[model samples]
Target: MSDSLFLGIDSGATTSKIAAVRDDGSVFPSELLQRPTGSEGGPEGVIRAWMRAIDEYMAEHGIKWSQIAGVGLAVPGPRRSYGVLDSGPNLPDSFNGWNVEQDLISALKQASGRMLPLALGNDGNMGGVAEAHHAIGDQRAGVVMLAPGSGLGGAYIDPTGMCLDGDHLAGMEVGHMAAPLHLLDVPALTCGCGRTWGCFEMYTALAGLPDLLNLALPRYPDHVLADPSLGKKERVLKLRGLAQDGDALALELFDLQAKAMGLLVGQLAMAVDPACFVIGGGLIDPDATTEAFRSRYLGGIESAALAYLWPTQRETLRIVPASLGEQSQAIGAAHVARLTVKAGSSVQPFSSTSR
Candidate 1:
């Protein structure tokens, strides 16, 4: 038994996942770990809690920490240059100045009594890397991954096998980009960060959709309060059901979401004509292939690209849902860990600060 098992962990707002893989990219369920992430406690507590979960999994498998080659952690926030997390709204403010990347490596080394290099990056970046490696296989050139869920996250990989970790480690912060608001007539909605209108989270995110639905609620009061499955799916299924039931309001909501997403795609296409646009998240239904995210969003962008900071090119864009679904980031973390260790380097965690 080689003690070269690679590990990857995904730290999200609601839940955290850890996975282990062999050097050949073969993953084993016996090596995977899942647990809740206590985001409210802030970054340090969350990391500690997750570390406990990982410890439990390792113990159950009778696997010593020393057996691990390296660990890769994908965090929900941006990467910091000096091992710190710049900002994460869902986390407590105590996480400020937390150097997530360095801290994890230190903890692992301390626990194992061995220096296991840790690799870190933004959750989105690792998700893109993971999805591309899993889905596209060897083609690493220019690929874009769009995550549409609680918030929007975008990751871009260039032709030279270089992942965009940024100079300050804040690469691919597209969720912060100002996506359009096709449904809102009001002055642009502000983000929790207190920015003015047109923020990305305010447009297509899970948080944004309910507010958008509320705007249409007055017209279709029946569905707002009466739908049995309303709150569970964040009213997404309700909106879709209503659309199916000929509720004008629901149809309007879906149409609005589609249009806004389309516009976003168009804008993204101009910046990098990605080989494939991998869409992943809770909202994207893998079964709903006919939705044509690229066509719809690119169409919107084609109409509105001139107004954009960067013009778009629609001819070469292909929009597709990520095949890995919710597990992309975790899988990618494993891949990254294995690659880093094989290269004879320590893995870089997302940040050095606790948050």
Candidate 2:
């Protein structure tokens, strides 16, 4: 392990996750915590949860404030700058008004009794970079990570394997890009950002699953999933279980998700042309109830892309599952803290002295 350690915070709509990570992206699973976030109480709810998680993890791992170098935060929206969040649709009302850097700096120092340099970045950007760094490393000339939950998020890596956070509005807004008009045969589902129908995010995430289910239900009237008591969550669980067994309704819904997702993936292949695309979030996990189901699900995504790949070859951009699983974002944020601080002494240099 390196002499320095860093803290990474991933503040999501429903949960806030935290961990202590090394510069090399290594993390001890024992030194992690997850808690509900700033939904009801606003920013204070978020800060309290974040601090409590940090305190509990540091205590359990015997890590001290002096050994920590800096803190990195991953907020789930576009950053106005390094430390400011421009929009937070999923977050509580206070998040929209609070100054992330100033508020976090004051609260974090109060928690640890020392001032640590804070670094901030978009959640999608960090998640993509983390997956690229771990999944492809130096082997790939380029990679892009697409997260398809809550809302779509994307990150790109150059040939040298370093993730790129492009200047405001140019890159990373891939989610906001319009989906093909043909895909919107169902009722229009507007995004929280107030975008109209046909947005890439509307058909790809769990949020979009309800809309997909409504469309699929009409066609699968004879299927067992049509039971009204099943609800969205239960219906999803049952369908995935059945899909693993080649059930028609289950397979068709997944196929629909892939077909919609492939539109965006296909578009990315033309513009960014990454060697591989890592897909993450709750929708797809290669590890499943059965090996056959996992293969079928992944295969569904690949085969569906053929329709949209157009000028580019169908196999151009490979798709893969997230290697680091849920920990990828937090680990990425810590790496950002580690890298940024190492780049400049004036940066929030973590204490290197051994306890």
Candidate 3:
């Protein structure tokens, strides 16, 4: 380990990612640890899993906490009230009252034997930062990140190429916005967060898309729609098979997903008018066949007379897939650690015991 290694952690629903970067901008896969977020066990279980992973990685790398610069974490939900995660309905009950930022800092202090400068922010904002620094290249300012995974997560990158982490770290909740559900009688889209009939998440999130597809095709008999046991990988593969076999239902479903995604991106473009939009997630198939996802997402941006929208005279929106693949959040967290370390002149001691 370098003398001043900065660590970044991207914690997602499935796996937790960690990366370390040296001062020279050279990055190494410090450790990639996979653990159940234990959302079922609640927030404390999630925190335990994370800490255990870090400890295991440290031991494996023969790295000590004192040699490390700082740690940055990319959390899933909006930071409510002093960096507490109150609205993460997916998180276990234990997380309801936990102050994530403060708790993590204390934990790291005990583990590292030094006060670690901690910076906690929304995962969406970190995704934006990753896009700006790694994907946008020369086009730094005015970038928006559309992380299309379980749902649509949004992040805005400013002129200096830094994502505004936002007050309480609630930068964007694009998935929670109202989306169209022409097929449903209720017309309201339901979200995983328990809100009904809104945003593309109702139809696009990994858990929600299959049900939406089934609902979209009410004409088909109820027994024909399979068990709906399809995961993201399986769903994408199914779409490819359907598209290959000329299945009209698959085509329609994919198109609907694209349009819903596009409209949401359009709304984001209207708000920020970014120079480029970076899209990322499991829905994006590697093969060129899924280019429609990119095109439809970009084509949805069709509004005029707004100064904030990019290209005042002409529509100049560039929608590109994310460059970092699945590691974007982890890398972004590493940058966060670097910044935190740079901001603080001295390292503080970590309290050995939990509060």
Candidate 4:
């Protein structure tokens, strides 16, 4: 342990990742811990699980409350205010309008007999923060990150390593941005966000794969993924295996996904003109597949994006995979906590009347 450490917790729909980061923003892989989020039990259960993980981690590592400078939590939904969520759609209904920061701090005080400063951040934004500081390391360059999973989430990290949340703290909802439906030759389909027309998320998210497959399956009835016996979950797994085996249909689906990604990146370039784009989330997980598929997918994205980018922009913009993988959000949260404590704002003792 260093003289002072920051604790970061990334609370996802299924898992909560906890990690300790040093002042220099270095996190040991061995110190990373993942626990079930206990979301079925709602907000309290989730908070309790995090507390237990923190308690277990500290006990195992011989860390004391005095050694922890602050804590940061990365959550999935939009923030209503600092330390609170407007709604946690991916989580249980109970998390809606929850003050996770205050509750977690209260739990820490009860369990550890001390109050620590804690900060809250959107998970997607936190991922970008981690990449901006730890992965890219160029303070002069802006970075935009797109995380394609069940839904598409995005974040913009400015040159100074701040995640831009805009005036209402609801900026960077890139997934809901209107997509070029013509590029995909798909009808204007409603997005999960309830948009009547196509959105970027409808074309690239895992949730949209089934719709894509349904549209394409008629042309390739014999496709392994078209088996009537296969359920949605199994079909995704089978598709990955097929992709690894170089199945044409699987490759085509991924290519279409890449094309949508490229268009989204190009559109973002015109708006943010980020120095680079970092692609992360479950969609890009290597999962034992050979690099060939990943390369092809990424290559397709770059090629398509270049067609849409300005000539001057084409030379400077780069697209890369997230280096930190699953740990990115946790590390970013820890970094945010460290920054919060250092700035001497949003650091406070637990007060029952604070809300």
Candidate 5:
């Protein structure tokens, strides 16, 4: 078992990342591999791109399928079952009815000529698992993770580092959760989830940035970001650079983001009473400028959240950035695969109809 390796794949709409982990839960970031998702080709093409990334990684590192103990794949969107997705908002319509887990398994067998144990999990839940056990290493207290990327996603990990998926397996759809819109003093905006108003993601995620900027741009006509030629997404992405340069409008946007995040965390804290809350995803960058902005933003969140909590809760609650950074999802998926194998579940030779 010392030499055994578990493979973790984080399959996102834009990119697919792969990493191998040892039995002891260690992984080399240098060995991580990725490829464009190639969603234009549909489900089969996306899976093939992922498989090619794995194949190239193994060949480059001299790894063989015989030494691999298990595999885990993390995917986005709501699940109808273990490996079947109900719909993928960021993915092409062709993938809506696909059983991604079974397809990946068949592709693996064809590529590696082995039926390895595999586990499929939601990307948010897998990130929580990694943060709870490997990154934060707090096995005694429950952990909650809120990842703000193109959209917001979350997961709850019990004290034992197991993710709680609930009866429907859609338990942690935090993005669609109703928020306290009145707290922000802004008009309620509809979310992609079809909520008429007040979805948390509508205030905090990248998808929501355009609306946020729209509200701000009216007052800052002279600002460089206010140029009509820059698309909404481009303007949103450029806000960070402006914030880095101490631009007032950009800083204000981040401040609003912090307050919204605080409100979301406060809501979760009251409901779940988790010991710690970890913030991850694209918004939480490791670069110096981003780190400085994140530090200030976190301070604002803490202040806002503290106002909503009792003294005891305030003293005990912890909010921190994700330690594993970009590698969290992949490392977490590998960790889940290892756990599945340890539970004595048979994942190899899986049937298309099976979980």
Candidate 6:
């Protein structure tokens, strides 16, 4: 393996992505390729799919296993630490109560024919690393990232562009944090974490949007989503479409949710006081017609976040969209691989035997 090349892999429930990153944080032209995650295929199926994709990516780019200095894998988490993924809301149930770390390491060794140093970490934490080190430039600053997808996730990066949660391995599970009690009802939205009501995700996260709408349906009898026949996907899509079209109900939801988000961000700011906040995920990546609505949503948060801040604190805080687009996780995984190999052992070891 070329010493300059590092391999990074991100395995999500629906897709598996791989990338080759250089030591200086730049990725190869053939940076990313995606493959099916094979969630229903069982463990063997998932492992084989990852192996095939990795092998193909390496061969297509003439990258040898020998040239690779390290390998990093980012997966969904909430285990004791990296490599110990007992279960995640995003992954298949088959992965729960299994030895994900060792199994993946052994499988990777068998597939690649090498015992390269490996680092495994939470995808959200790695995404923070990518955002800190690669995205938004090389400057060292305190950056907080909020990815609103299936659920909300957060990662904090210190001024040196290093992950703030590295000491713990798994990044902060911000979505599970409680929301304002006043905004919650007894039968509030059901969150992915299995909690009903009060979770910050109830008002955010694409997956949680439908549940939020379900609660709001009763208040707007004439709203399209009020129809009992609409499924979750239909409810969410209709809401999104209406919001994009400047529908009053949808716009009001954004305006109202902004206050809740402002409270959360304000609370976080009171604790960490980060330099900037970067927001991302499919929720923010609207197409041409929806750009205006996207701006409104972001604007709402920006304005609301200031509610709790004084003039001085609000003056310096900045929030923006992800500059790296969808490649943040892949690139961050490679960077973690490079850093792990350099350190000889990761602070969050992928295998229990590592220390």
Q: Name the best candidate (by lDDT).
A: 5
Off by over 4 Å in 5: 38-42, 109-114, 218-222, 226-230, 348-355
lDDT by residue (52-128, candidate 5, tens digit) is: 88888788888888888888888886777767777766776788778888788888888668887778888889888
Roughly what TM-score does model 4 have, to 2 decimal places?
Answer: 0.89
Q: Once model 1 is optimally superposed onto the true structure by TM-score, how far is the C-alpha of residue 341 displaced, in angstroms?
A: 4.0
TM-score for each prediction? Answer: 0.75, 0.80, 0.75, 0.89, 0.88, 0.86
Candidate 3 — what's its lDDT? 0.64
The backbone clash count of each candidate, in order, is 26, 1, 14, 0, 0, 4
Give the winner by TM-score: 1 or 6: 6
Quote the lDDT for 299 in model 1: 45
- The residue pairs in collision within model 6 are 1-66, 1-67, 1-68, 2-67
Q: Tens-digit lDDT track for model 3 on 137-250?
A: 545468877776656777887865567765544557777778656532324555667887565676555556656665655665442244466554565456645654556667
RMSD (Å) per prediction: 5.2, 5.2, 5.4, 2.9, 2.8, 3.2
Global Cα lDDT for candidate 5: 0.81
Better of 4 and 5 by lDDT: 5
lDDT of 6 by residue, 1-355 (tens): 3347888888888998988788676777774598898878877788788888888998898877667777778777766545565766677777776666677778767765867677677788778878766545666678788877767888887775556555566446778788875743324566767887568876766656665665667778987777778787866766667877778777766666655666677778877788778877764775433677768777888887887876777998887777666667777788877876666674346565563
Error of 1 at 76 (Å): 2.2
Rank order (by lDDT, best first): 5, 4, 6, 2, 1, 3
